[model samples]
Target: MKKLALAAGVAVSLVLGVQPGSALAAPTSVVLAASQASWDQKLAVAVKFGLGDDFALVELPDRDFVIGIWDHVKDDPEHVEVRVAAETAFAAAPEDTDQLSYEFIITEVYAAFDRDVERERQEAEAKRQSDLARSAAAASIDVVADAALLNGSDADFVRLIWERVADDAKWPKVKAAARAARDGADSDRTAFIAAGMAAAARQDIDDRIAADEAKTEAEKALERARASKKLAANRIGMPVTDELLNLPDRDFIIRVWNFTPDGSEVQAAAIAATRSLDPVVWKAYIDTGLHAAVERDIQIALERKYQADRALAQQIKATATKNKDLNLVYWTDKALAGTPTQLDDFLRAGQYDLDLSTSFGAGEVLPSWSNTVAWTGGIVNVKPICCTLTGPELGVRNEPGHTGSTSLMYSGLDNNTTKSYAYLKSMALSRITVKSSTRLSYWIYPQSNTVRPEVKPANSTCVAIDLLFSDGKNLRDSLLKDTKGNRAHPAFQCNKVTVGKWNEIVVPLGALAGKKVTTLVVGYDQPGNTGGYRGLIDDIKIAD
Candidate 1:
């Protein structure tokens, strides 16, 4: 019978031109009037008229009707819990007409309203806590900013203020303002400290409230900013302040200290400056002290070099004396007597280039016929039969020479008379041919102890070079001119001879053109006040 009643209800809905069981479908005037009545009135009419199963088809109400009720109460504070519960239930059976019945909806809404109410209370409390945290942070920043305003030049104090709100994510405006103030001009910094910070902080708070951001996230953001700022500052060697504007000065001093030699004056000055831990001291050192110390250090190095060069010069002088290198010995003596620069030059290059040597051989002078002879009066005599007087002995000694290891040395007693003469000569094996362009060149070193003092300075007539030709002619009477315009016999008169230095003599044989040179002689005459006489001769060359 119930099945029959349900079929009958559906049939009646269909005949009325309405979708069966569709409450949204337009209904007849009787059904519309019935739907317009209250839920209680509709129920009473159905029971009184014995509507039976056809009551279901009467289009009592659907999801749209429940949705309307929900909308009305959803925002009502007094019924917030109930509205939330109804919303949950309605949403579950929005399309199921059986589950969306008024009785089921009302029962579910009232039953779970208390749980929703408790949840709402907890959420409100959490929001309150978060608000308090953000407010507290902002208040702390305000206090610091107020303190910073009092001393603008106090970098530490200003830094403290910046640190508090430098990169607060919950306060982006505040962070930006702080950065601008920290890095900007004095006026910008002053403005931020005076009022800009507070305004920016307030803006941040409003932004946070609007976004409903949690306080825990704000704390984490603050920590991240602090870590990032510290890392960046450390990596870049920290930002400069008003007092420490010259950063390069500090770096330069540090490099000097590190790179200079350990016990040096420059290094010492750099160490003292750096260790003082005063920027003023560093600046002073860079400006004045460092340069002064460096100059002193250079002088010290020069002194050390002088000492070393002097020692080396002494060693070279000794070697030159042993080798009879008069040129080397002369330069070494000069270097020792002069400045360190001269000594350094001699040691470095002068010793090798200045020392003279000869290519002439010992075979050119017949050793067996080489002898020394002295004459009482200033007479040119080559024969041994002359006034009997002890002449200086001729020997090869390695004491001083212009060009060779050994020179023909004349040493022994001499008559203390101005007219006395002593000479050493080497007779050639054969008469050597000569051309008009041929010249005789030789170096003479006169010992200071042997030569007369009067002849040692301007001109020395005592020293002479005599050549004997196979034509029975000699240079003493010949009109042959030396490199200087003086005759060959009086060579020392033409050239000034220093006692301790080598003197050169050159005689052009153009006067004896085509003459054959048989003998060569270097002699000292007029031993004015001598007890003994000594001299050296070297580099005997008979070339054109």
Candidate 2:
């Protein structure tokens, strides 16, 4: 009777929804079959249609609901009842409008149901794999820990085991086991490893401490040696100290030359002892040889203290010249640990064009000769192409080999006028210079002679040639040649006068030989002239 009632209802639905032979009503038939099919078959159909999770659940709530729906359509025996139930469920849904809506909903619901099942399966598999990984990690930790405990005394073994494990969290146990092994019996291998590790660490620390102590001792010895140096004032009235010998630290070496009063070796000894630490002190003994300034015997005892300063300088120069990087030398009292510098070969003065390719940015001014702080190592006799001026006129003054002070100004008319001078504001001579008989050379051509008229006082109109010392003092003075004594020269005369021609002037190196030459400043004295005196100056060269 129930089956009969269901058939009657299905028939009524067909009457309301499908025409006797309409193609549009075919979907309605499919929906009814889906709703009434067996749970398994309905699930299969749902997967094919890609129904959502909730829709699949909505279709098959329980086993019995499936059975009831199936029973209503079972009479057909062609499984038509399943399609009828699906069609009915779709008709009942909120979104259904056309009779075919039920068929579409049933198809979608079954698809989503299949996807949900597959997703669950994948999740379970992932969890299983994760558990397996954790188990493997835990097992590895056990193996590492056992290895550490068994051979804790051997630092290499322990270190090797940890390398295999490579787990930071497990380090504590390994460390503890190692410590225990170190404390164990001497015969224990684990303890031996621990001892080795400790010994290595101790050795490293000891080495550093020794190095620091040596440095400290060297510094102290240098201070004492410098204090005892003999200084003499040269003709330029600058104090020049005698040469200091440089030596490196070594176990045993013959550093001090000519120990005996007769320039013969007396006793050779290792350099490790404090008494023979520095060579500078011993050089003093050599200076006042066998017949010492104080006691002859004292000089003999101090022969080993002398170090060869000149030899050291030569060595330093050799090494520095080979260095590809920008090499700069600075004077220091510190004792060199290796070869010393030989400054003589590197101290020649010549016009130098500063090579500045290594710097990072542009617009960087190249250093000119005479700037003491220009290159490394205190200035010797070198000519700068132009001064990198300071103050407001820094970038403004572009002429090479120019030096000037704010106090002196140049008159554009004559080179001698100092009223408004054209100067390289920041340039200055180094503290060290060459002071001997020197012939100054430069080409000077005046564009005008407005300020210091052609005939000015001989002494007053003279161009001061100063061999500036490092301590801010000039050493020489020379006047422009008096071709016509007491008569001033015109601005346009080149060959005979100091104007309009590129005249080659020669200066003697002897002028800068005895005294240290830091800078060479060429300018006029007081009553200086101002602008409008134009001089085309070039090629200021210095040579022996």
Candidate 3:
């Protein structure tokens, strides 16, 4: 009966819109053969009770209703008599037959509860499997993405930079960036690979380039060190150590020469080469040797000097002698001049003969003949070219003159100071130049009016050829003679002359009719005014 009722009960659960008390209508021809039946009989009975194969207690709570199954018998005509008898016995209440019917109902209800619980467990298991599979698949995708990027950078590109190294943990993060670069925006696949590699190796690449450059520079320094040692050895006939090579080329060579015992042509050549590097060192070395070679050089240099000044002192003297160009002989004796006083008094004689005819040069100026300053240590201590000793400065320019390539040029500028003088004073002659009746002749170009007579006079201011006479005496005697009444000299003042054109100014030495002159001075007297005090004086000479 329990089987029969459950079969019919499950079939009624499949019916759409069947309420708790609703009956499933079946055909009157269908019949149940027995009370307790097999599964096949129960199936057939359920079909005959008007139920489909699709029935489940889990989906419909009303499918477990006892009334639904009771309806199976209520609607069946073929089993109506037995169904009626069973119903009357179930309704009478306190008999074993009635309890049997209740037990059947309890079995059906418990069976439905069991089916619903089992169904819930199966559904939960399926969902669990689905969630696990989804997580595993996502992990696989992450691993694949990160591995691809790492492989792009030479297999070893990825590393655990932190102390805690779980490659699996970092995979997702690296994969995210690489995947964005790879599949998101970048169109080129190779770009992803290159970018990954560079990002990984940036620090390493910079360090390598720096190391290579440092190594190359070290190699070059070693090569230079070797070259310096070789140069000192081959050139100076001595070996230079690595320490000495640190010195510059000039200083290094000088150190080597200072130690060299004998200076031969090899040593000389080495020193000469260093002259471009250090002239003072070369001069110290080469100038120490005294031989025919050096004397000949001196004579050749003087031979090219102002033609007339070279006349008498052209040949070097073995001893102090007269009849030489007194000025030339004095300066030429620098090699053996002992002291300046001896050279000045080289001639133990009377006044200088005033051989102005021979004192003037012919044609062109010599490179050796420059009287740009006051004389000292031969002529090397000549004074400034031209000056006013105040506000204005004088410029000296050299061009073709009456005789030589050199001439005196006084640039014009105003001097606001009182008693300002612009003069070019010749160095003291070793001997005196006697001129009393002689005529002082020179070519002059006075471009401005500073030298005209209106400004030049005996007392106030003038532009003149100034002179100083030494009386051919010693320093004290010369100063004493200048202090006493016996001393006398004059300046040949400038007269009215053409502007911008060369004019000859011949001054008769009647003012100094008896004095012998030693120092010849030229340029402006103390004329106070705006001085573009410009002029050129050349071919200065004295003749009877």
Candidate 4:
């Protein structure tokens, strides 16, 4: 049967003479009319029935308290409890019955009871929300940690509880249990926490067994992650433990183990990684690396050959005809065809009559900014700005050439925001003979882009090479370029030029027909702020 509300149930029980049962259960109301009486109406009924004071004792405008009282006191129709309450009110009045008012007392009591009921309801709701939050926090402990707690490895479980359940009512019990597991050896820790779990679950040792099992699984996973991390470092070629540069080979990298191997998981993984690579792949890698070493040796050999051929170059330059001098021609051809697969292709490219350069060739010329050689043109300043020159000689060893040419490192820059130019020229070399078939060529190695504002600047914003030639009468800028193609010059920059490596720049004499030339100038010009622009010059040649 559906029960009526507290006040209504109490009122109906009173009006219909139904005896109240226990504190928890009230009988179903067959009469809905009395059960639905208003609060003021119920107060009036309680006053008229001479139970107004007893009603106030309920501390709420509800019938549960009344039902409880009925169980304790109600035995007759002329209820002694109500009579005693009324007599007590009268006796305490100190006035006659006419002055006594149970109605006013019941009204105040009913209002106070309503407030108390609301307060109690609010308190109960707050408690419920608090419990929900705490429960959620406890359940939110990491699954890994939870399993750890159930098993014997309770470190994660202890830390999780400390973080989430610090303020919980049940925290102390679990905290002590987790602390025991965390602080003790595996067996002792599990035994203590399991004992606590046994009490909370109010069961036997099976709960403890489950906890121990869960802990074992969580710990196993932790160990595996640790091992994998250490192994990953080895796979990527870092130190598996102490030494990185030299590590043991594949066979020594890992050892198979049947058990947990307690303190050696990472060691085992390192060994396994090395073993995995022991077959044909590692040998292939070693073979591939040998190519660079072989290439370096080849460069050394070529430089020696070049040094031996300098006297030969002078002899050939003085006498070789357009198609003769096979030795000089053969070697020159080889020098130009870079890194060819066959020696024939290598020996057929740099066909030249002159290799008028240096591997800084057998001399220690001092670095002089002033050009003292009368045949070699002096450094000229094109801008109104003053610039400083560093080395145009042999002894300054700052930058190195290909096979150590004792390179020319020239930088002519200042702190000026205006333009400046400092360049090396070959104005006096008119008598060094080249036949009608002659062209000038040399290798330019870049530490920076040779092109100006378009390419990235290394130090100087402008770098260029110019050849001054006489159209039989006046010397003019015959070829003006900075290693990039310029149609205006029409002599140099005949093809695409790349920087950061040696580039063979070849200029045919036919391009300068009816012209006599003496000067080859390399110039640096710029608005100067980043100073010290440097380039490497090597194996300069005038060949047929």
Highest TM-score: which candidate? 1
Ranked by TM-score, top first: 1, 3, 4, 2
The models' CA-based lDDT, in order, is 0.49, 0.31, 0.36, 0.36
lDDT of 2 at 493: 25
Q: Candidate 2 residues 14-107, lDDT tens each?
A: 3222222422101122232324344565455444434223243335433223333434333432333243233333222112222233333445
Q: Please give, for residues 229-298, the per-residue lDDT of candidate 1 as tens digits.
A: 2221221223324333323556666766766678888789888888887877866775456656755665
| Residue 336 in candidate 4, Cα distance off native in Å | 29
For model 4, the run of ten residues with the poorest summed lDDT = 91-100
Q: After superposition, how far is residue 221 of candidate 2 from its true place, in Å?
A: 55
How well does candidate 3 match the true structure, expressed as C-alpha RMSD?
A: 61.5
**Which is the leading candidate under lDDT?**
1
Candidate 2 residues lying further than 4 Å off, grouped into runs, are 1-437, 448-466, 475-497, 509-513, 522-531
Deviation from native of the Cα of residue 422 in model 2, angstroms? 6.8
Model 2, 50: alpha-carbon shift in Å? 99
| Superposition error at 471 for model 1 (Å) | 1.5
Report clashes for each candidate as comma-separated counts.
0, 94, 12, 14
Task: Give the per-residue lDDT of model 4 (tens digit) for 1-544.
Answer: 1222443454433322213441211123332211222456555545544556654433433333333333332333234323222222221111211122232244423432343344355446534433322232233221222333333224554455555545654344455555665666755543433233223222212233345555686665443333332333322222334342233333223321221133343344333444555544333222222222223433554455444344333432332222122233334444433342232222222221123333433342222222321111222322221235243321234456665636654444334445433444322222223455665665656555443332233543244444433111111133323223442221223224445776666655545543333334455544433344445555555545
